[model samples]
Target chain A: MGMTFTSNVLKDGLSRIQREIDAAFDAQLPVPDDMSASLVEAMRYAAIGGGKRVRPLLVASVAELHNGSREQAVRAGCAIEAIHVYSLIHDDLPCMDDDDLRHGKPTLHKKYDDAIAVLAGDSLHALAFDLLASPEMSNDPAVRAELVHALASASGHKGMAGGQVMDIAAEEAGGDLDLHTITRLQQLKTGALLGAAVEMGAIIGRVPSEGRSHLRNYARDIGLAFQIADDLLDVEGDEEAAGKALRKDDAAGKQTFVTLMGAEQARAQASALADQAIGHLSAYGSEADILRELARFIVERDR
Target chain B: MGMTFTSNVLKDGLSRIQREIDAAFDAQLPVPDDMSASLVEAMRYAAIGGGKRVRPLLVASVAELHNGSREQAVRAGCAIEAIHVYSLIHDDLPCMDDDDLRHGKPTLHKKYDDAIAVLAGDSLHALAFDLLASPEMSNDPAVRAELVHALASASGHKGMAGGQVMDIAAEEAGGDLDLHTITRLQQLKTGALLGAAVEMGAIIGRVPSEGRSHLRNYARDIGLAFQIADDLLDVEGDEEAAGKALRKDDAAGKQTFVTLMGAEQARAQASALADQAIGHLSAYGSEADILRELARFIVERDR
Candidate 1:
C-alpha cells in the first residue's frame, strides 16, 4: 500500500546511458574531413540535441533489475535511444508530422534542411542496429540476437509502421471513430516501441522466459497508458507547458480518446491503466519499483 | 564479354520474397471494417505500391552466393529492400529531395499527404529490422545477430548517413571537390549499402572471413561503378529513358565525378572500376558469374 516517488529513482541509470550516448555521438562525429557536411551536421543534430533521456534511462533500469551488467544495459539503452531519436527526426520532416516544434525547439529538419534530417534519421536507425549487434552487448551471441529481434520488431512496420498507417488512415477518413480503433492504432504506432523498450531490457538481461513474459505485459499496459495520457494532454495541456502545440489533434481532424470518450473518461482510463501496469510489478518484487515510478511519470509529464 | 540482359536474374528469389512481403503487409493491414475509407486508402497507397525490388534482390543473391539458402537470403533481401524503400520515401518528401517522380510514377508523398509519406517510410524502416530479427532469418542466434549488425551498419550514420553528409556538404560548398572526397562520399552514401548487401549475403552464407573480405571489396567497387554510371546517365541520357529529370546534378549544384573529371574521363573511370570489380571474382570462378554479370550490368544501364 505504499509507493514513494524517488526524485532520482533512475538517475544513475539515466546519467550513465546519457553519457554513453554522448560518447557514441562524439566518437561518430568529427568524421573524416572529406565527408559530406550535411550528413555530419544532420548526425550531430539528431544524436546530440537535448531531449528528456527517459527511454535510455528506462532501458538501463530494466536491464539492471533483470540482472544484466550495467555496461551491457547502458549500451543497449543508448542503442534504443538512437532508434528513438532517429524516428523523431524522420517524423518531424516537413512531409510527416510537419511540426516545427519538438521538445520546445525546431525539429531536426526545421533546424537543418530536409535532406540532412532524412539522412540523419536514416543513420541513427543504422547506428541502433550496429550498437545492438556490436560486441558491447555480450560475448554470448544468443543474448545479442534476442536484443536485436526485440529492437527490430519495435522499430518496423508490424509494430510502429502498422500503427502509423492506422493513424494516417483514421485522419484521412476524418469522421467519428470509436475509442477502440483509436486505442488500437495508438497501441501499435506508439505503444509497440515503448513496450519493446522494456521487453528488450529483459531480453538483454537474459531474464527467465516466464519472467520476461510478465515484464512484457507490464510494458504493454504502461505503453497504452502512455499513449492515452498523451492524447489527453493534447486536449487539456498548455502549449508552453507541453513544449508543443495543444489542440492540434482537433485541428488535424484526428480522433483521440479525449474526442471519442471525453476528457474525463480518458483521464480515468489512463489512471486505471497505469495502476494496472504497476500492479504487474508485484511479480518482480522490489526489482521493479523503478519501473512503476516510470509508469507514473509517463502520465504525469506535462511535456 | 558475353552478357545478355535478362531481368530474370533473381526472378525466383524475388517472387518468393515478394510473396512474403505481401503477406506481411496483408496481415498488418487494418481490416476494412475497422476505419474510415481515406485512412485505408493512404495506407494502401504507400504499402501496396511497388518497385523493382533491387535492394532485397541484392540481399538474397549475396546471401545465397555466400552460403545461405535461397529462402533465407530472400527474406533478408526483402528486409533490406524495405529499408531502401523507406529511405526513398522519406528522401522524396517535399522537405527532402522533393522529387515528384519515383519508379516512373509520382512519389509516395505526391500521391498521398506528407504525413502519410513520413509514416509509411518509418513503417518500412521498422518492418525491415523486424524482418531481419524475425524467426524467418534463423533459429540460430548467432546468424540473426550477424544479420542485424550487417543491415544496421549499412543504414546508420557511420555508413550511409556519413556518405549522405559528405554528399550534401560537397554540393552546398559548390566547388570542385577532389576525386578522393567525391569518391568517398559516393561510396559511403550508395556503395556502403551495396557493400552491406554483399556482406549480408556473406553473413547469411557464413562465408569465411577471407571470402567475405574479397566479396565486400567486389561489392564496393561495383557499387561505386553503379553510381558513376548513374551520374553519367544524368548528364547524357534522355529524361524519358532515365524516368526522371536529367542534369539534376548541375541544377542542384552537386559535384559528381563528371563535374570534376569531365564526361570522357568519368566514363573511362567507370569502365576501369567495373573491370576491377569483375577481376575480384576470379577466386570464386563460376560461383560468381552472376555477380560478374551484375558488374557489367551496372555500367551498361542507360538509366
Candidate 2:
C-alpha cells in the first residue's frame, strides 16, 4: 500500500522522534551493575521499545514551529514520554488494570515480577523530573524550574494520577458517565499531559503569550479529538487492521465517547475538532503542515 | 510522667515540627470538590495523619545549624516526608512487602483500594518535586533546581527505588545477602534519602562546601546507625520494651543486621555509629545539641 503525503510526513517525523527518544532513554538509564540489572532492563523495556511516539512528535513539532532548540525539545519529549510510560506500567499492575500485555509484549511485571515493576515505574517518575531539571535539558534554571512545575502539575493528583482515580471510579460506578463528566475525566487523565506537551514546546522556544495561547488551543482540541479517535477505534474495528481494534471498551465496561455519541457522531466530532485544531495554527502558515497533518493522521492510522 | 531533658527537648522540637508539617500538608493537599477527593484524602491519610516526623526534624535541625530559614526548612521537610510516605505506600502494596499495617494503622491500599493507594502514592511523588520547585520553598531558581535534582537523585532508581528493587531481590532470593551487599542496598534504599534529608537542609541553608561535607558525613553515620537501630529494635524490641522483640525477622525470613551480626553486636555497632555521627558535629558545639540528641534518640526511641 502506498503511503499518502500526510502519512509519509507523519511517519518520517515519528521515526525521528523514536530514534531521539531511544537514544535519550539509553543515555539516561544505565544499569549500575548486576544488582540493578533487572530494574534497568525493565525501564529500558518499557521506555525505549517501540510505540507510536505521538507525544514526542507533538513536542518536537510545536517546538520546531516556535524556533526552539531541537535538542532541547527532544530532551523535553523524553521526560514527557518517561512519565507516560511510568503511568502505563503502574496502571498495568495486577492490582490495577491487571493487563499482561503492552506494546505487543509481556508487561514488565509479567517479565520481572511486580516489585521490580513498581520500583521501575517509581524510578521513571523520578527520572522524568530529573531530566526536566537537568543541565542537559536546559542550562537556564528558571526554564528548568518551569518545566518541573508544569510537568508535575500535568502529571500530579490534579492531572493524570487524579484523572486515573476518577477513571477507576467511573468504571466501578457502572461506566455510565455523561458526556460532560467523561470529557472532564479524559481532560484530566489524558488531555492535561498532551496539552502540556505543546505548552512545554512553547515554553522552551520562548513563544510569546498570544502565540502560546494559540498552541494550547491547538493542543486542547487535538487532545480531546485524539481520545475520541481512540474510543472510536476501540468500538469499531480498524478497517483491515490486525488484532488491536474491536470493542475492548465493552469488555472492560468503559464509558467512552463512542458509547455516548455513537461511532458515526464520534468520528465526525473528531474530524471537526481536528479541523478546528488545524485552524488554531493559522498564523503558522505552511510551517504548521506537520502539525496539521499530524492532527489528521492521528485519527486515521489503522494500528 | 516527668519528661527527661533529652525527651523534653526532642518532644518540644518534634511538636513544633509536627504542627508545621500538618499545616503544610493541609495547605498543600486540598481536595478539589469531589473528583479527586478520595485521592487527596488518601494522601492526607498517609501523610498528615501521624508519624515520627523524624525526617522533617532532621531537615529542620540541620538547616537550623546552617542558619537556613525555618519556613523553608519545614517546607523542604514536608517534601521529604511526602517522598518517604509515598515510598511507604508503595512498599506496603500487596505485590511488594504485603504489609497490612504501617505507623500502627491500616496501610493505604488496605484502607482504600490498590488503585487509590497507587495513585495517592504517585500524586505525593509529584507533589514533592512540585513543592521543592515552588516559591514557598525557595525564591532562588538555582536552589529550587538543586533541590529537584537532589531529591530526584535520592528518590530515583539509583537511590530509594533502586534500593527497594534490591530489597525485593534480597527477599525473593531467599533473603540471602552478604552483609556488604545488604549494607549497600540499605545505603541506596534508605540511607541515601536520609542523608539527602540532611544534605538538603545544608543546601537550603546555603552551608559552605566544607560544612556541607561535614553534615553529609554526619548524615551518613546516622543513616546507617538508624537502620541498624531499627534492626536491633526488630530483634530485641525497644531496649526497655516487649512483645515486639525476637524472631520477627526469622518469621519474616528477612536477613537483618541483628540476624547476621547477632543482637548484641548490632546494638554495639549502632551505638558506635551514633557516637561517630555525633562526632561529625564537633564544630557546632552547643548548637548541635538537638542533632546530637537526635542521633541517640533514633536508636533509643521506645516506639
Candidate 3:
C-alpha cells in the first residue's frame, strides 16, 4: 500500500463525511419555537459538531464500492449515526455510565436535565427509523423497508441494546469473562451497528444477500479490529486526543482485549484483522481504495 | 345507538385486542438463556399482560372498517402497542415520573434496575419499527414502509416525545397554561400516537391521505377526549382500578384539562367530544359500530 495515498484518502474521506453528517443533522433537526425547542437543541448539541463520523464513513465507502448514490447513502448514514448518538446520550445518563463528559464537552444529561436527556435520546431513536422510512431514503419502497429492517434489527435487544445488557452484566460479574464472551459482547455492542452500516450500503446498491458475502466478511473483520483498537486506545490513549474519558475499562475493571490479551498481542491481533479485512475486498480495484485504507486506518489511528 | 348492542361490541372488542396484544408480545419477546436474559425478561415484563391495549384496539377497529386483513391489522396493532408500552416504561423512570408502581406492580426500573429499564424500553422502541418493516406486517413493501413512517413520525420529538417535553415544561411553569396551550400539548403528547393508530390502519386498508379526513377527525376528537377522561380518572377514580398513581397533575402542580376547566365542565366537554367523534363515522353505518361504541366508551369508562 502507498502510505501517503492511503493517508490522504483516509483524511479527506473523514473530513468530507464529518461535514456531510453535520449538514444532514442540521437539515433534519430544526428546533421549533415551542416548549420542545430545548429538546431539539439538545439533539443538535449531541449530534452536530462532534464525533469521528466513522460509521457514516463506512456506509458511504461501502455504498461507493457498490455504486450507490452519494445522496441516499448520506441519508442512510445519518440514520445510522442517529442511533449511535442516541445510544451515547442514554449511556451517559446518571443511571448508566454516569459520565459527565462526551466529545470533550458536557454530556447531554449534564448540559440539559436528565428528563430532557432521556426524551432527546428517545426522540433521536425514533428519528432514525423515520429517516430510513422516508421517501427521501430511496425511490423504491422495498429499499426503504429493507433499510428500516436492517437498522431496527441491529439496534434492538438481539443486537446493540442486548449487547449493552451483556456489558452491564459483565461488569456486575467483576469482569471474569472469557475471550469468547467478551468478543460476543463487543460484537453485539458495537459490531452489530458497524455490520449494519455495511449491510445497508449493500441494500442501497441493490446487492443480493449471496453477493454480499465478501462485504460481510470485510465488515466482520473490521468490526472486531475496531473494538480491539478501541480497547487499546482506552488503555494507552490520551483523554484530550480521544475527546472523551479514557481508561474507563481499566477503572471499572471491565474485561477488554488489552486486559485479556495484553497490549502487545492485542495490537498485533488488530493489525492482522485489518489485513484480513482488506483481503476480503481483493476483487475490487481502486474504487475500493477508500475502504481498504479505512481498514488500515482503523488499527493505525490514535483515536 | 342501541345501548346493549354497543356495549357488547365494545366489551368483546377490547377483550379480544387485549388477548391478541399479549399473545403478540409473548410470541415476539422470547427470552434467551444468556447474559441478556434479564434484559429480555424486563422487556416481556413491561410489554405483556398489561395496559388497556387501547392503541391496538384503535388500529384493529379502523382496519376492520376498511376491510383490511385481521391478522395484518393485529400485527400493526402490536407495533403501535410496543411504542406505547415503551413510552410508558420510560415515563415511569426515576428521572421522569419517579413512579414506583405501574399496572398494579413495581415499575421495570424498580423491579430490576435503571439500566435494564432503559435498554428494555429502547429495545421495544426498535422492535416497533422492526415489526412494521417485517414482511408479516404487509404483503406490499409500500405498506410496510408507510407503517414504519407513520409510527416513527408519531413517536418522535415532534409528536409523542415532543409532547412529553411540553408536559415537563408545563409542570415547571407552575400550571399557568391556558386552555389552548394545554390542548396543543395534549394533542402532541397523546393525540399523535392515537391519530397514528387510526392512520396506520387506514394505510393498511389502502386508504390514501385525501380519503382519510373523516377517520382523522374521529381520531383527533377521541384522542383529546381520552386525555380528558384520564384527567377525570386521576382526580376521581380509584388507584386500584386504574392500576397506577392518580392525581399526579395536582401533586405536581401541572396544568391539565380538569384544572383549566372545572371537573363538571371537563366531563361535559369530554362527553361532547366523544359524541362528535362518533358523529364523524356517520358515513359507515354498522361497519364502524365498534368504533362508534369505542368513542362512547372513551368518556364513559371509570378507569
Candidate 4:
C-alpha cells in the first residue's frame, strides 16, 4: 500500500529539494570572514527562517515528470525560492505590505531595519540569477539562458512587477474590481512567477514546445489556484498555521477571489482548476500522476 | 572638425536606438485604457530623458562589427539602458545615496515621494527584462535566453549587487581601503553593467566567443575607467559642468578613487585604462574606433 506506485517518489524528491535549497541558501552568503558578525548572522536568520518550500518542490516535481534530472531542477527551484524570499523581504518593508509575521516569526523587515531588509531583498534578487548562471547549469548554456530569461520575465515587468503596480494602483483606486480585472490582477501578481516556475523547469528540461504549452497551462491554473487558496486562507486560516497574520486582505479592504466569488464558488473554482490542471497530464500517460496529486495538494493544503 | 569622421555614422546609430527606446518604453506597457498615468510617465521620464546612449550605442556598434543586425542590438541596448536607469533610481533613494540631483535634474525620489520612486525603480527593472524577452528576441529563444542571462548576471549579485554591498559595507566600516578592495568594488558597482552592455550586444549579434571576449575586455577596461573619471568629477568637477553636486563624496565621507588616489592619479589611471580599453579594438581594426573614442570621451568629458 505504501510503496507500490511511483507517486511515493515525490516525497523523496521534495525532501531532496528541501535539502538542496537549504544548502543553497546557506551557500548564498558564506560569511565574508571580514564582515561584521551581526550582519552575517542577521542575513542567515532571515534566509534560514522556515517556510514550506512549495515553489521549489513544484519545480522538482515538474522536472521529474518530464524525465528531467531533479538535481538540475532543484537548483533552479532554489533560485526561485531565493527570489521569492527576496520579494517577501521587500514586500514586508515599512513602505510596502509592512507585515510583522512571516514563517511564524518576525518578518525580515521587522527583525532587522527597513534598510537591511531592502538590501537583503535586493541582494537575494541578484543572487537568484547568479545561481541560475552558475557552473551547475553550464552543461547547457542555452537551457541556463532560458531559465534566466523566464525567471527575469516573470520576476520583472509584464509579470510580477506589473502585478505589483496593478496591486498598488488597485489599492489606491479604491473600487470594486470586475471579475476579469481581479483575475488579470492575480494572474500578473502571483501567477506570473508560479507559471514561470513550471515553464522554466520545462524549458530547462528541454520539453517540446507543445509540452511546454501544456505545462504552462497547468502552471497557470495551479498558480491562480494557489493564490485563490491563499486568499481563502487569509479569511479562514489560522495565524499559527499560516505563519502570518490572517485576514490581512480583509483588513486592507482588498477585493480577493474569495471576496468576489464567495467562499463556496471559490472552492468550486479551485476544484475545477485542479481537475483541469491534472487533465493536462493525459499527454504524459501515468508519469504525470504526481503533478496531478501535487495540484490537489496545493489547493487542499491548510497551510 | 566638430562632427568628425565616423561620428556621423555613430550618431545615426545612437539616434535610432534613442527613438526605438522611446517607442519601446511607450508601447510595451500593459494595455488597458487607464493605466497608472504617473507611473508610466515616470518610467518614460526616466528612460527617455536625454543621456549619452553609450551602452546601447556599444551594443549596436558591436552588433554591426559582428555582421549582426543593428535592429537586434538596438533592442538589447535599450533593455540595458533601462536597467541602468532603474539602478540610478534605486541608488538615489533616501536609504541609499540620498541624492537630490541626477543628470542635471531632480532625482526620482526628489521629484516624487520615496514610495513612488521605489516603485518606479522596481518597474523599470522589470521592464528591462520584459524588453529583453520581447518577441524581437523571442524568435531565437536561445539568443533571447543568452541576452537575459547576460543582463541578469551583470545586474544582479556577483556584479552590480556585489559592488553595492561592498560600497555599503565599506562606507559603514570606514577604514583605509586597500587598492585591491577599491578596484573590486568599482568593478562590480559600475564595470559589471558596462561589461554587460558590450557583451549583450555581441550576444544579440551572435558574435563569436573570441570576439565577445575581446569586447568584454574592452568594456571591462572602459567601465573602470569611466568610474575613475566619475570619481575625479566628484572631486574637482564644478557644479555647472558636472550637472550634479560636486565633491559630495568627500562631504559624505565616502571612499572614492579621487579621495584615495588623489585627483591627478585618478585622471592618470583613467587615461591609462582608456588606452587599454581602446587597445582591445585591435581585433575590430577600424570599426571599433568609435568605441575607442567613446572611452576617451567618457574620461575626458567635464560632465
Instruction: Please report the candidate that would top DockQ against the real structure.
Output: 3
* Candidate rank order under TM-score: 3, 2, 1, 4
TM-score per candidate: 0.89, 0.95, 0.98, 0.87
Q: Write the per-residue lDDT of candidate 3 for residues B180-286, one digit (tens) a residue.
A: 99999999999999999999989978888899999999999999999999999999999998788998989998889999998999999998998899889989988
B95 Cα displacement, candidate 4 (Å) = 1.6
lDDT of 4 by residue, B249-282 (tens): 7776887888788888888999999889888788
Q: Name the TM-score of candidate 2.
A: 0.95
- DockQ scores of all models, one per candidate: 0.57, 0.82, 0.94, 0.35
Worst 10 contiguous positions by lDDT, candidate 3 chain A: A1-10
lDDT of each: 0.73, 0.84, 0.91, 0.75
- Candidate 1, residue B238: lDDT: 80
Arrange candidates by DockQ, descending: 3, 2, 1, 4
The deviation in Å at residue A269 for candidate 1 is 2.5
- Candidate 3, residue A121: Cα displacement in angstroms equals 0.5
The number of the candidate with the highest lDDT is: 3
Order candidates by lDDT, high to low.
3, 2, 4, 1
Find the 10 residues in a row with the least total lDDT in model 1 chain A.
Answer: A1-10
lDDT of 4: 0.75
Candidate 3 residue spans exceeding 4 A from truth: A1-6, B1-6
lDDT per residue, candidate 2, B38-139, as tens digits?
899999999986678888999899889878999899989999999999999998888887777776677899899888988899999999988988666678
Stretches off by above 4 angstroms in model 2 are A1-6, A208-211, A238-246, B1-5, B208-211, B238-248
lDDT (C-alpha) at residue A27 in model 1: 69
